[model samples]
Target chain A: MKLLELVALEKRYGERPVLRGVDLAVDEGERVVLVGPSGCGKTTLLRLVAGLDAPDGGEIRLAGEVVSRAGAVIVSPEARGIGMVFQDLALWPHMTARENVAFPLRARGVPRRERDRRVAELLELVGLPDAGDRRPAELSGGQRQRVALARALAAEPRLLLLDEPFTSLDPELADRLRGDLVALQERLGFTLLHVTHDREEARQLATRVVTLHRGHLGEEAR
Target chain B: MSRRLVLGSAVLLLAIAGGLPVVAMLAQAFFAGGRFDPAPLAGLLTDAGTWRLLGSSILLAAAVALAACAAGIPLGVLLARTDLPGRRLLAALFTVPLLLPPWVLAVAWAALAGREGLLAPVVGPGAALALDRFLYGPGGCVLVLGTAFLPVPLLLTMAALAEIDPRLEEAGRLHAGWGTVLVRISLPLALPGLLLAAVLVFLLALGEFTVPGFFRVDVFATRSLERFAAFYDVRGATAAALPLAAAALLVLPLESAFLGRRGAPLPGAGTRRRTVPLGRFRAPALAGVLFVAGVLVALPLSALAARAAAPGAFREALARAGDALPRTIAWSVTGASLLLLGGVLLGLVVGRRELPGWRAVDGLALFLFALPGAVTGIGLVALWNRPATAFLYGTPLVVLLGWFARYAALPLRVTTAHLRGIPPALEEAARLAGASWWLRTRRVTLPLLGRGLFLAWIVGYVFCARDTAIAMLVYPPGRDTLPVRIVTLMANGTPGMVAALCLLATGVVLLPVAVVLPVLAISGREDRR
Candidate 1:
């Protein structure tokens, strides 16, 4: 089954149409990577999928649930059960790695013990068990990415969204993390939609690659 | 063409608003006694009252500055660094005193600490234990002014604290503990800003006149005004003003020494998170915050409320205000409009064009920022209060000129800052696009500066409305601004009247906040750029 589907999604800023009609889909447990140059609506697509922004037209369906419909209902990010790691990481500076991972669980009203247990396991999963007490500011570029990933996975999300997550990390660390992420996804059996400008990263990580050009999405073989 | 016209118009308006009355005042002072006489200088220097007032003023200002620093710094740290409970509410509450005019706070404080005030019922008469005695002397002046001016340092320190890269704290947290993080990283980074804030608060406190006047404490400001208005000793008043002006000038060095190199941006941008969670000591901190807010806002408001409840007092005050309100409005509106116009013109001249003595002109405009209002009033009155200058005195023009001279800095500062932000390349581009200098300014520059001009006008208006010292000395018989009227009512022992009028006056002072807050909110949503 398709885990996520966008039908003729369009967005505009005043007279300028930033995202023209775009259609795309990702299968369940599939690793889909989006590649494009800057300002080619790559981040905009991610934001639309994450429900941070509303599309000017068309529909978005996630897990067979109609998440957005033009001129009708639109689901909020929290309600959509979609997890996102922003390009800038957007990690709450005040929260520790553990607390950040525990946030979605807390928001979903998971009990404190269970939340802590899940957070610890996730921190260990991301190889940052000891770093859980440190805030995002304390961590290195790569460590922060792991904390972000650990946070996104805390709610046991069906689909994970990563936007240029490894862009700020060192190349070696990025490659290592990419391998770890792929292994983690395979082990966890979760679908992933990642956005990056690097073609090499797309080839290395994606099962299927999609290219966004002037807001039009075209499937490309990895 | 339209934009240039608007720019020119705006400048013209500011000039008219700020310049004419100043010219009138100078004319009055210099030509009043058939010629300028330096005789009053000797009399002013010899007067024991003048010396006493100056000493008291300096002491009061120093005390207030210290008190403000003591309260403001800790609160700034707590608000910025900790996940203290109700931090947002506490931040907002702290700004309330800043919005209120000093005279309004003075009147409210008087009602609370006076002999017949709310505490009188609980403490009994002649109770040395009561705050009434403290409220009427040097102690009262410092307390009231300190509380009133605390927001400046609090804001500056908070901004500084927020700018500290959160990563540094996080690194410290990883290596050591929260205590170590705060001591080693946060406090050191925030020190420059805190010292800068202290200097700013001190400078502001030094110029304050209304609070001291309300407390019946003779300060330099009041003494200067008395010399001019009562004794008609123009030279004496001018001489009296020299020291205060010198003290005000002291701020320039302090500002440069402490704050010049520090480039910490305010906390409005780059803040990813809205709330920071508290780990421990939340409840006690919350209680302390609540207690401070209660004392600062609730106590004074309650005193005013009590006085307003008295029989016929509110009505009587309202009736008097009703009689005075139109004239007050006219004076403030006219004065501010003139000041804004003058400031914009002066700012534009200083900003875009290089001319002889332009730096001196700029300095003269900013000079009033440091000088106490009484000193400015004294200087103007001294220069204008002559037999030959009879045309300027006993006329509304003198008041208007004083308002302009005192407040031109607002528009000039705002305009210059705004102008600096608009890249010169834009103007060059317009020129490259076949636009004449006049056309480019009209179509491009003026339109861009609309918001700045509006804001400058609003600030100028608020300053004019809130000022009492300058208005008190220079106001002709027919023109009394709201603050002057409020001060007069307080001086005459009409606490009820004072409270009512002050409340009314404060609304005028805070009008700009109503407009500014919404614009800020909308802007915050639009850009992190």
Candidate 2:
């Protein structure tokens, strides 16, 4: 069975239609990159899959369970075992690096010792061993980016969603982070669905590239 | 007090003033001879007179809210979004009344409508009598209370309008006319705050004792006071207070949610870019703002000034109110100080913890704040009229305590707003750095919230200074706040002298607000730079 499935997904805000009848599917461990023009509903699709929003029509299924359908969520985001790094990173600015990483574990009710151990490992994995003590405001751009990735990976989610997180980074730093992300995916074996406006970055990181034009999805040669 | 003691005591004080009294009254309402019985409450509910009073009260509140929103929302939108001439000056003038006590405004309106009122000579005897009759009933109460409470929505709506990204309007502008864009885009975005303001106005109108009292309107507020002070019926008073409290609780969640979503009263992204051109509307719009100012500010003040100009009348009014003036000022200062101390103690934990249940604290404060002054007075008497608490009940301390309880929420919420704006990452970062909640709050949150706390303090001071309803209910026999004195002297006193006393009360209230305004302006400028 496919790890994720979207069938005839439709959404609108008031009278303005967005994501009209979009359908796609991804197998376990497949890295899918969605490239689209601004306002083409790529982020909306990602948000729906992560259970942040419900669609207006049609259904979304994960692991053969319908998690979302028109106008309601069958499964909540946390219960769906999915993680998302928002376009703005959504790092809890009140939290330090490690606490942001450790938050999912704490929410999952892991004990302090185990939570601390996992947080420390994630920080080292992201090459931010000492940056754990600093807030998102104090951290550099690349460090904050890594902290978001470390946080997404902390709870060992079966699927991870990234929303144009590295768009602000320099090309050199973006390339390095992309390679590191690919390696991390290889080692951990989690499904990745990434949204980007950059064609080169999509080509570099995606196993299957898809173009979203006016809300419809089409396969692109990879 | 230690931080724990301070916090505990502040919460305890909040409980005492906000909860304990209401509980005391409700306890009487729900039980008789120490056995559970809903008979007294049910009696009030079933009474035909009780239903009439409730109906009248609801009608008065609905009329006032509708009237206030009718004026306030449009004014807020025009002032905030349009390039109306003298917009900034008009905005500031409109805001001045929020600091002035409502009864002061009532006194002004009375002066403008009385037998010897501003319009009495101009309109003549028959017309004046007819006007005074309307002004003294539900109609007059609605006009006065609605105008008195106008600033609440005005400030809230302007703040809401300021938050909408200019780009949203710009996007709409491309495909549609400005009118279409405003209706479809800007108005919808500003609707939350406009509605929130209307909700507050409705609650304020319902709880309005002063305007209704001055006008001789027999609404639930007046009825509650009559039940407590006139008939000495504790169960009856509590029974009367029940529905108002229930009304507050009904809307508590929405109020909390709306307030929680916004920052302080003024959140400016930059004033210049948000304004739209008034074009042909400027001259007419300026007339509307001037009319509002005349009705809300100038008429009352000028009436007082004209009244004060009467030979020896001002001094006689002063003599009658004598110590009440000083007492009101002293109690106001002391009350604001107590509220500030308590607010900081309570708010520090609520703001720092960043718990979801913080909304509960906010809702409780607002609910207590929304309770009719008569009910609050009744609650105070029920709780503290005993021999053991007689010392407090005998002094002006009770009135001061009442003020502290009523207005502490204003400051506490302000402090919490400031604390919330301190990014959550700051707390998480501190947590990771091995700092406990206390340490992080002490070292980070408190320092960041200093300005907010100060602003809240100033607001508390002005509100305490101007309050009359609670003071009238809770003040000891010999003591009266300025508001109570001015109100008392209104009956059988010279219209001029009464206006003078009202003006005096207005001055005391505005003093702190005036001092803070320039400082706030300077701070805002400094921030922009």
Candidate 3:
């Protein structure tokens, strides 16, 4: 069964349309990657799915529930149980890596012991075992990405959204992170909707590669 | 809901509380003969005494700005680059004088040079008398205002300095010595911020009435007041204040240009990685800070407190202005809240929207902020003193209107600037985590806005608390604000009693700031930009 559906998704800024007539779907455990050039609204489409923003004229359904339309949220972002790793790695600078990872659990009112245990397990899984106390600023570029990944996975999200999450890292680090993320996704068996401009990353990580052009989702490449 | 709607609300709030009063004042001034004639306003404008008042105001503002820059620049550099002792504490202490009314400093200086003052015995009688004479004129206005305003430049320069890439300074250091590099590179880069701060000081000094009034120095603000409060010449008062408003109107654009949409961001949650050791200059910089604190912060406060320390002086002052004290406190809180409300709305507009219309709103807010307090006060009276609006005019509401009109820009600018730096993802992440809008605001938005909200309150409250020029005109009979009460009581009350009241007012303003600043600094997220 489809875990996510974008039905004729359209978005615009005034008269200029950014994402027009975009249709897409992903199965419950499919690892789908979206590839696009700059300013192709890849991020916008992801934002719409995550309920970060509302589309101008379309509907988004998550797990068979209408979530967002042109100007309304049928289900709020948080209530949708979505987890997103932001393009810039929007880890709260005020929080340590451990706290950043644990915040979603805390927000969900998880007990302190459970939150701490999960946070540590996720950190260790992401290869950031000893960097839990360090702020995002103190961590290296690759480490920050790992911490973000750990955070995205902390809620045990049914679907995970990644938006150019490895863009800022060096090529080697990006490749390594991409491989680890693919392996993790396979192991966890969660549906993945990731946006990236790198064809190699998509080829390596995705079971299906989709392209967006002029706000329209092109035919599936794989 | 819509950006336009939010901005429209802000503009409407400003129009009611601030813009209408000026409109009423202008109408009164221009149509004094009950026609469209500009004869009275024209005559007042071209008059020699009017020109003299304008000249003196310009002169005073220039002198104060110059003095403030002179004091603020080196201190700013010291705080920013050098490993100064207790820099945060010093920065907070620097704003101490500013939290009090300008006139109180004049009162403190008066007490300091009096025959029974602290300095009377140390300094010879002749010297003390000479000092007394000096403290009661334009020199005194510049001295007091310059000291109060020094932090304006210092804070701005520190923020600007932080924004400068330290590598540029280091690159310069490879070629030239630190002093040469500082004068050549760091100083040049920070000039715009320094000048912007100076312009603020200029506008502030130009708009001030209290210091000059206490010193018996005749500037435009004092002239405007005397015409309204003393001689009951509303038209003449309006005429006198028109030039001051014109000055504000002319300068507001420059302020916007210099400060940008964010109204000149200040140093916050700065890292100490870029600091330079002062070496031999350390002692002098520390000594300079000490001297500034002594002259600007410590000395005047000691004198004021000493004068008030006489038995029953403080109590008598409080008893005399009993209702006025609480009334001032209560109105100031209400006024600050109102100001913050308008400020948040306007700030969101200015910070978020890139449209030119928001700039117009910004210009209007800044113009009203810099418009002479007497002008704002008289404008409120003219606008509200009528049968239809008699309820507002007959109570403290008019005074609150004056407060929001003149000072709301402060919080708006501060909050907007802070909001600008906060990424949209910060809230989105929270929202996607299942936090409701209310929960997001309380946890995400409010935490980010932590100190900024409190700082806005302080800015709004300090201005409202010490305000006199506007309060003096708009305050209803049998009701008095603390600043107005203290100034008026100076005539009938003993010197010691007045001094105690000034000290008491300072304490009132400082307590909240003292408690709030450190807590926010420590607890608030390291902005780590």
Cα error, residue A200 of model 1, in Å, equals: 15
Put down candidate 2 lDDT per residue, B80-122, tens digits, no spaces: 8888888888887877767777877777777778767888999
Over the stretch B1-529, how does candidate 1's per-residue lDDT look in tens digits? 4534644554444344333334444444334457765455556668787677677777778889899989888888788768887676688788778767786777787677677777777777877346787888888888788888888788878876665655334323322345545665567667767776776677778777677767777777666566667887665555556666666666555544443334332222222322233556788888887898788777987887787677777687778776567777677778778877677766776676534454555656655666677776665565566699779877888777777777887788778767866877988899899997668766887777777877787778778877777787777775676677776666574667677777777777776667676796577467544
**Which 10 consecutive positions of candidate 3 chain A have the poorest summed lDDT?**
A86-95
**For chain B alone, what TM-score does every candidate structure achieve against the true structure?**
0.80, 0.90, 0.91
Model 1 CA deviation exceeding 4 Å by range: A1-222, B1-53, B78-92, B123-129, B159-193, B257-259, B262-277, B342-363, B386-394, B413-431, B434-454, B515-529
In candidate 3 the C-alpha lDDT for residue A82 amounts to 71
Candidates by TM-score, descending order: 2, 3, 1
Ten-residue region with minimum lDDT total, candidate 1 chain B: B265-274
Q: Is candidate 1 or candidate 2 better by TM-score?
A: 2
**DockQ of predicted candidate 1:** 0.03
**How many collisions per candidate?**
26, 16, 1
Worst lDDT run of 10 residues, candidate 1 chain A, spans A69-78
TM-score of chain B of 3: 0.91
| Candidate 3: clashing pairs of residues | A78-B434
Error of 2 at B296 (Å): 3.2
Question: Against the true two-chain complex, what DockQ does each candidate achieve?
Answer: 0.03, 0.02, 0.01
